[model samples]
Target: MARFVAGYFRSGRIPIRGVHLAVVLTFSLLAVTAHAEFPLPNHGESVIVGGDRAYPPYEFIDKDGKPAGYNVDLTKAIAEVMGIRVEFRFGSWSEMRTALQKKKIDILQGISYSEDRSRTLDFSPPHTIVHHAIFARRETRPVRTLEELRGKKVIVFRDGIMHERLKRMGFDRELILTPTPAEALRLLASGKYDYAVVAMLPGMYLIRELHLSNLVPVAKAVVSEQYCYGVLKGNRELLSRFSEGLAILIKTGQYKEIYNKWLGVNEPPRVTKELAIKYGAAILVPLLVILAVTVLWSRTLHKRVEARTAELAQEVAERNRALEELRRHQDKLIQADKMASLGTLVSGVAHEINNPNGLLLLDIPILKRVHDDADEIFEDRFREHGDFMLGGVPYSEMRAEIPRILQEMQDGAQRIKRIVNDLKDFARRDDAGQKELIDVNAAVQTALRLIDPTIRSSTQHFAATYAEGLPPVLGNAQRIEQVVVNLVLNACQALPGVDRGVSLATGFDREQNVVVIQVRDEGVGIAGEHLPQLMDPFFTTKRDTGGTGLGLSVSAGIVKEHGGTLRFESAPETGTTVTLSLPVPAQRG
Candidate 1:
């Protein structure tokens, strides 16, 4: 019935676009203008954006000799919202690269990222992907791969990704270099070269615009890579702004419009007037019949409704009173049921974990005692045999390592017991634990020992500064250790590579009379707006990486329980510093 009635109204050609279009237009305007006035560095000063002169559609100078292409338009859109003045400099691809190298240009609007280029340049997240193809003239033998071009003459754009790739792969023999993709394709079409390698889109675009009909792309995608904006290495300020602007354009749907205008295959399917007319009557007759039937049914339903109105009203009042009474009882019961179920689950999980940890707790010490008794025997065997393998390491090496490994196991088992205890406490709504006067440095050091493997893999540079003359704070040592582990691991994960560093420091704040532990990382930093919510329950930016958002929130609660505070300070591309402060315990004298 709904389908037929909808068809009937649509057949009359009712214009339902008025409201929908208005809503869409309003949001588009809002999206674009929301950050239109964002202030940029060196505001009002024109930053030179560089691009290739002969690369069509992506970036190029038009017949009027102005920078006008997909890259140009996209850059303009970004500049508008980012509120930066940009001037376009169009030249040979090599010259543009040189300009960027010399710092004469502040941005390269289009460049594919490569490790070789990355040595001297930094990139924003890719905005699009570029596919390179091998081009040959019609009636020539097709080459599917670069190896097929072993003896054939080949042309490639100078200083381009393909050129470097060919050199690295030892396919550089008989290579001819052209200044731009357009010139290379033009040369290949004029039979100046056996084949040319260029970006597929620009090759296709130039063929249509320049009327180079004889040239054809023989291979589809010989090399595909992320196409991005490039800046001189260490120009993070400009890099971040462009990246943010691109994100905004994408979120606003403006990026799709620009992409469709240039690269997107936008040929809309056509509908013929004759075909529409042929099906028009077939659709309309059934719709009219359905409309009549619906009207008759609605009239009968209206009469029936009127007859039951008074009786329904009386029943509704009686039911409402009973329902209100029942709902009150249900709410309380549901709350109790939920709490009971959760407590059971927590207790069950804790016990299940304690089962295995119990073995490590009980068995590891016996293993250690056995190792001690046999150490003398093993030493005699080693002295005579010059060392044999034990558990994949020489017995001499294992002699020292075994004790450390066993001790680590012992520490790990104890930590597991503590964690299980914490879980059981959670189940019973008990945060109570025996407090001790903790040496802030010693507790943090123990936590570091437990997670040393994570820190080693995450970064090459790590520093620990244990400040002296710090008064001990009263708290559960394991809980304090738990908070330190969380903060350090969060720092390690924030680092993008092993080259970045993570540092931890302990200090005394005489003014606040609190001992402070600071964990810092040279990683991608958090945004300022997120700082306040960092300690809020169930809020996280690391959700994609298995973050439940409870780490900081739970750690905050732990610190609060010990009469302390947790604070975060950070910014993009810089790093984050998490400070945990515990107040010094008062004397009872």
Candidate 2:
């Protein structure tokens, strides 16, 4: 909603009008000025009262778009007691105050009674007692003494009674200000302002309504001011009538009843600024100095944090360098393990071929003797009985049978030789070696041999359970061996201090076309929470005991390379079982 105000500019200096003057000017000029204070007509019908609509629990808008509050109800009660009809007018506090001053409203409800105000307006006798006190955050003690506040920042409502009291007490006038008590207290409670002094009744209501725990009353009512009705000065008849009505209410105890209804059961401690300064100075000054010191200390700590951050960055760089070196070493180990596996396979193939090659060598001489005897017989027949031998039918059949037998032996030797050549090519780890189908079981066994010495020396015992007739797996043999070896060595480490054995088991899942290997330990089990982080590189529980934390990560990488998965399950009181599953070779079309 855009609110507009009217004021004519003259010679670059805008002239201001009083509340009533603006109303009259608007009527004559046929203009509507939002700031103008129009009369809330009495009409010998209703007693009119004006209040700050934004002020809560005194006079403000309610959910139904109607005026409501203690003051609103009190005014109606006062009118009922006086046998008069009543009407309410709502506006901002500044506008309401101006309206009251302009004789536009007969009364201003919720006015705090003060002596200085009496000179300009007639005040009804005090209707209620509301103590005034200071509030601060729980983290900050309330300002109980004037001396306690000497060097601290305090807040007060502009032109409020507290401001006057502070001035009278010779307080330094540099405190912060807000337009209303609520704003000042709000700022104080939020730590934006150090302290605020408000009427105890309003403060209590605010604290409860705002659900503010940190705000509390500390100082004694500088003066226990009363809440009274304020009438414009020179309105004696109206003023007298209000006072008489108030007296009747008071005499009937209705006023006290109303006061108690809103403010009973709240009896805050009584503390005066004089008492505060006398007993609180010794405690207050030291705390203030400590707070100052703490602030400085925190700033110094921030600088140290920056320095530590730089140190951490340097450490990260050094760690990266070390990780690169470790990666290179792991690559070398993979290559070496591959070569070792290849060498074993080649040696096995050579032994297999040696038997067939020796058999062929022994059969060759007999085969040659048969051929020579036949050739001599043929030559003699050609020289003497060639025609007769040509006529002999069974002799050609025998020669044909002998040659066929020799050819069969030669073919058998050739097949064995070809198989041996294939083994050599497969085992070669030179630059020209290509990926090929491999026996996963053989790879696993070879890896066991390579890491067996390390496992035996590091742990208590070892065992193997391998399943036969496993299908071939497609992978780099060396990489797969490295993976197995690292897994075995890690299992061995987990079994430290345990006299029990570590078991390495391998099998195949026919349906899934995958080979599964599990390495289990009867050593100490991994804690549940620590299991999740075991494969995270550089995260080790054995920092003090010599663990690099990289072995598991590397093993996991190798399994992934072979289209495989590595997983584990462990319990705190039991043992850990690490399983690796590699896919079997894909079928050829």
Candidate 3:
């Protein structure tokens, strides 16, 4: 009874056996034709089909190098029903469609249904149903009212039903048509389109595929459409067979099973065109308002970022300028310090020479008197009464007067020469003198010996305390001399104008194996506040008196370069002590 009812529906009649045998025969023949399970028509062994390879979830090549998707599955089913092994050729959809019309392929599958499509090919009953929906960014609000979309742009697939619907609603001016559903969705996610009419199922598939949460369905579905497999228009026999096979699949519930497998569950409240229009307006109006607010916020943030960047640049520039100015001032102060030290050295040298030279002048008159007496005796030549004169003459006449005068003159000249040699030794400057091992005590003694003139002129005395068995230190001898000279001169300068002056001391701190030299002076003490800045370049209390301010600074640099330390102690109105600590030579080894 069920088969009869299916036959009646399929053939457009009630099955009455006696009255329409020819009709039953014809219906039966069509039924048999639909089930004709042959390898191919008598002329060929296979069927050819055309498809677009890039279209995913419909007609595409899978990673395993096999054709896969809903269309591939549907084509296989139809081939099974037709009892033919099929081959596929791929190209652009337009090109494929043209090839199909040229009778180059036996069938084309998974094509969206349209009135214009009917002009080119005959279509089987629809295999899948889909709708056109607007996709937009999640930040966008639902477009619910058409009147609110006055200035917004929307995108649609080319030759889509959306174009016709939007034109009818006077929104054609705002429509932007795209070639692919994927492209439209991308633009929608980026906020380029206020609304995009794209394939509803494909859009949903991508949303899940990409795990995209920032996009939303902005407009309601505006139209529902169906997809069908097609054949060229002249292929009536192939179309007839396809229709019959489709009816059998439907009657046997196989079509529903295939649909359910690819598409999943049939959702309740299927979206309609009315719902789409209603929601499109519902979504778009609020979206436009939100977009306006977002644009304003972005502009405000950009301005703040630019402002902060400019402020940072300005601060950096100011800091660089300050550092450069400080460097220049330091260089100037160093030059001034060298000149000041040179002047002090000149005065010390003059005083040192004066002592020896003055002693020689004092001895000169005695030598001249002795020489005159000896010359007078030699001129007389013992001419008068030698024997009688010799008896009466004193032993002083018998003495070797010339030899004694010559001996005294030689001694004075040697003393002067020794002082001059010491000055020369101290003044020798090897311009390329780099770091060398040196006796710390010797360097200190040389500095003081050269400065002895200053000590005498100041009416001051210097005392030294030496450490027994102190080790040599690694350092440049000339540089160490310069440091000692700077310290001793600074001590002299620190002293008040008085008979009592400064003391030079040297020792080793046994536990540290370090050589230490100290200069102590009875002078007006340094103020507490200035002590910390004593070694700072260009920082001086005696600028008004032409103080260069770099004596301590240069001393500090030399000491630091030798891996040593310089320290000092001072009391208000009392005195000051400056100390240097240099590492022992044995430790450096």
Task: Give lDDT: candidate 3, residue 390.
Answer: 24
Candidate 2 structure, TM-score to reference = 0.37
Using TM-score as the measure, the top candidate is 1
Instruction: Output the worst ten-in-a-row residue range by lDDT, candidate 2.
Output: 1-10
| C-alpha lDDT score of every prediction, in listed order | 0.76, 0.64, 0.63
What tens digits encode model 1's per-residue C-alpha lDDT throughout 168-225?
7677777899888888888888879699988888888888888999988898666655
Using lDDT as the measure, the top candidate is 1
- Candidate 3 on 1-589: residue-level lDDT in tens? 1123223322424222211232223334434434232223554556787776645666766678778767777677767786757788876566676787777777887665555556666555555555555677777766643444557888765544456556766787898877666666777777686877666566776676766667766654434454566775545466555555565565567765776676644222544544657765664566456545655655575566556656666779766565556545654554444434443453465465667667776777667677677656744655542311121121223234344545657665665554444334333342325777788888988887888787767645668877777788888887888889878877777777856568888998989878999888888889999999998755778776445566676677778778899998998778899889998866533
Write down the TM-score of every candidate: 0.41, 0.37, 0.36
Where does candidate 1 stray beyond 4 Å? 1-41, 266-589
RMSD of 1: 22.3
Q: Which stretches of candidate 2 lie over 4 Å from their true place?
A: 1-44, 54-60, 146-151, 167-172, 265-589
Residue 563 Cα positional deviation in candidate 2, in Å, after optimal superposition: 99
